[model samples]
Target chain A: MAIAALAGFVGALTGLGGGIIITPALTLLFGVDIRYAIGATLVGVIATSSGAAAAYVREGYTNIRIGLFLEIATTLGAIEGAILATAVPTSALAVIFGTVLLYSAWQTARPGPVSAAAAAPDPLAARLRMNSTYPTPEGPRAYQVQGVGYGFGLMAGAGAISGLLGIGSGAFKVLAMDRAMKLPFKVSTTTSNFMIGVTAAASAGVYLNRGYIDPGLAMPVMLGVLAGSSLGARLLAAARTKVLRALFGLVLVFIAIQMIYSGLKGAL
Target chain B: MSRDGGARRWTDERIEKLVGNLLRAGVLISAAVVLVSGICYLWHAGTGAAEYHFFHGEPSPLNSVSGILASLRTLDCRASIQFGILLLMATPVARVAAAALGFYLQGDRTYVVVSLAVLAILALSLSGYWVR
Candidate 1:
């Protein structure tokens, strides 16, 4: 129980790959069932989303409009993903999901700069008026969103993966918003925070209907994650971004390797 | 980069006002619901009719008729319908809130309408009638 809380605390501080971390720890270290671990992880996802979103909303960091708009695609895609997961064979899905997680980890480890050129405002971005600014040491600077359509499409895909794999798509969503849409890093992160809950909620309902939710497992995870995420939110302002990002990247790589190993072992 | 642009600088004073309004509204609505629900629960508990269980399967004292009645009255299926309605309403509310917050934070309204539209869709989807 203490371990779960500590893991959740660290996970929340780092944008929640904690469940991914904890699942292995629980199964390998504590000998809990994988099924139970996954169930608890889902609850943790919800708790983290809710806890982080409320603070982000209060702080005015989240782009609620964009987040809400994109949620339509994500929510629908999540339902479809949940449905597909049940229909497919477990082993086949495990191999595919494991590969995707590895690819995602690799991509996250080497994030790129937001834009190459201070080019003219993208026509689509200008038309949609999808440009905004934020506080900086230099002063408030405007950023224009590019490739919103592409970003939304990617979010839908990521949402489906989230539902199918029981992993929060924060990293994927952040990637899409940051890389494809050209949103500022802070805005992308906060907007992703706002939308993840809705995406998780969509699939969570389907999972509940399918009897995937076990109350006993969910209770402890949810409570622990809720507490942890709240604490993490408090620390966001004080924490150093460079150090956090490095730690986050390392954690993702480790989890991806673990997932690959587990998948191969299960197949064998 | 222009002379006109120099005139338009981000001001914390404007942002604070917008955030204050949103906080006030959110608090007002959330408090109302909590208060009403609390009253209903207390009334049921006093009457020995309302009943509920805690996480560990312990029977709560308010599991009698009054308890059930209060729950049904205060938070019945109709409440879900109402929540769906509120969610729909909240999209625009969220948009306004976002716009207000964004304006306060950045002196811009880039996502106000976009946020409201999303809320509207969420409300429609969650309405239950649509799902049925």
Candidate 2:
């Protein structure tokens, strides 16, 4: 539970999912099965996403209209990925998890893309009314959405990763929204948080039906992450997130190595 | 977006506030249930981390929606905890349903259709479509 709390704090601080820490800690440090870890952490993902999103939604950072439009692809992909989780070998899942961890760490180290070219609007985006303004220091800044089709495709992949790995896919979703669709980083992150719960809930049902969700294990984890994340959000203004994010990125790398090594050893 | 041939009953702001309340309330209630059930469970089950590290699958009652409800009459701590988790899971599903309603009120036909499609997928998954 304490570890899960820490995971949530770091996740909120670093814009990473708590599952990245919880799953590795459960499987590597605690010797819990990866499958069970995934199941339990999926619950935490829902808790944190829903809990955090209320504030975001009310604050108007969440583009509910845009989010709903993309969710069709994500929900479809999530179901497929959840079903795949049942068939995939545990060692393979570990390998995939490690690879994703490395990718997330790399993504964390990278800067947000500057999409100066995104001013041009797509007919599809305009027709769908995805173009909107977010509040900035100056005023509500209008931004045109480009590449709706491409962003939707990436969102599908993000949902698959969310289901298969039990992470929030904050990195992947930002990649779709910020990089592909050219939403402001703030809007991307907040809207991603808003969308994550629905994506995870799509997988949650499958996880439950597969008998992977252990209440005894999930109870503490869910509560701990919820509390810790809320606390982290509160403390966010006081903390130096740049340094913390870098340190967390390094931690992700270390955990990734450990996961991959153990996975290879197990496979052999 | 209002093409519904009438004044919309709920403004987007009001609906957004409702959604925000729904999400927070769902999480809090579920967390309270989990916390109480967890304390009761830990008191009875003891803090045996060793056994819990293994992956022995749960029984049918703990694994299915109907089963979770049916077993609640017995007041098993695990079942209660599962029920809490079920509520947590339901929040987002309900949010999607609420979103559909919001868009319907706003008369955004495209978005209403989109929201319903996502909700249908969630409903399918909850119905054991993947598992069966």
Candidate 3:
């Protein structure tokens, strides 16, 4: 319970999926069943989303319109992914999901341009009025949105990954909103928070139908993550970004190596 | 320099207006749906055939409604349908509450619409129209 809480706290801070940390810890460290671990992770995802999204919305950083529009794609994709999960082999899913997580971790570690290039406004963004400014330490700043279609497409992919792997995929969603749509980091982060719950909920329904959700496992994880993430969000503003990023990178590398080793051993 | 300043100020006004329009439309629709759904559920509580199993751990068919209104009854269902309902309710409540807060903090009308949209989705989902 303490380890799960700690993992949730770190996950909330870094916008990483608590499952990426918790599932392995539970199964590898605690010797819990993998099915139970997945179920617990789903609950953690819900808890993190509910807690963080509420605060993000209150802070006025979440682009609710964009989040809602993208959810259509994500929700549908999530259902499909859940369906696939039951049909696919567990080992295959684990290896693919781990590879994807590692790639996402690598992408997050590399710095990217914060602002969009000067060019013709994307037609989809222009239609939706997705371009907007956000509050910063300086003042309200302007940002241009681009690639709405592409961003939504990425969200669909991310949603599928989340459903199949029982992971959050906020990193990928953030990348879409931040890089492709050129939203401010705060907006992207908050929007990711808002979208994650709905994405998870969509698959959660399917998981429930398939009997993947175990209430005993889910209860402890949900309660732990909700408590831990609430504390983490309170601490987010005061924490140093560089230090957090370094810690996040280190955790990702460790998890990735562990996953690779586990996959190879299983294969062998 | 003064002309550039004037142009910038004018653009800001236009931008604000556009955002305001979107927000107003979004919030009004979303909130109405949520409020109505919540009211309907409460209204139907008296005579509806819906079962109210508090601590149901697993899903099963219930012919008659069983209302467990107290906190102690929460553990009757295996997965807790009541808890699921509460969880479902949280999304809209949070959305509306957040939008209201956003309005107070940023004075942005868009927040209001965002709140409503969140509620609308919840209401629609709860309606069971899309469940199948």
TM-score of 1: 0.67
Worst 10 residues of 2 chain A by lDDT: A233-242
Q: Evaluated on chain B only, what are the TM-scores of all the candidate structures, in order?
A: 0.40, 0.89, 0.33
Model 2, residue A248: C-alpha shift (Å)? 7.7
TM-score for each predicted model, relative to the true structure: 0.67, 0.90, 0.70
lDDT of 2 by residue, B6-68 (tens): 325666666778899999999999999999999999998986664556677889888999999
Query: Which residue segments of model 1 deviate by more than 4 Å?
Result: A22-36, A114-121, A137-139, B1-132
Query: Best candidate per DockQ, number?
Result: 2
Off by over 4 Å in 2: A100-108, A113-118, A235-259, B1-11
Q: How many backbone clashes does candidate 2 have?
A: 0
Which residue pairs in candidate 2 have backbone atoms (N, alpha carbon, C) closer than 3 angstroms, thus clashing? none
Which CAPRI level is candidate 1?
A: incorrect
Query: Per-model TM-score of chain A alone?
Result: 0.87, 0.87, 0.90
Identify the leading candidate in terms of TM-score. 2
TM-score of model 3 vs. true structure: 0.70
List lDDT for all candidates, in order.
Answer: 0.56, 0.81, 0.60
Tens-place lDDT per residue, model 2, A142-247, is 8888889999999999888788777776667766887678776667766877788899899988999988899988998999999887776566444553675576
Ranking by TM-score: 2, 3, 1
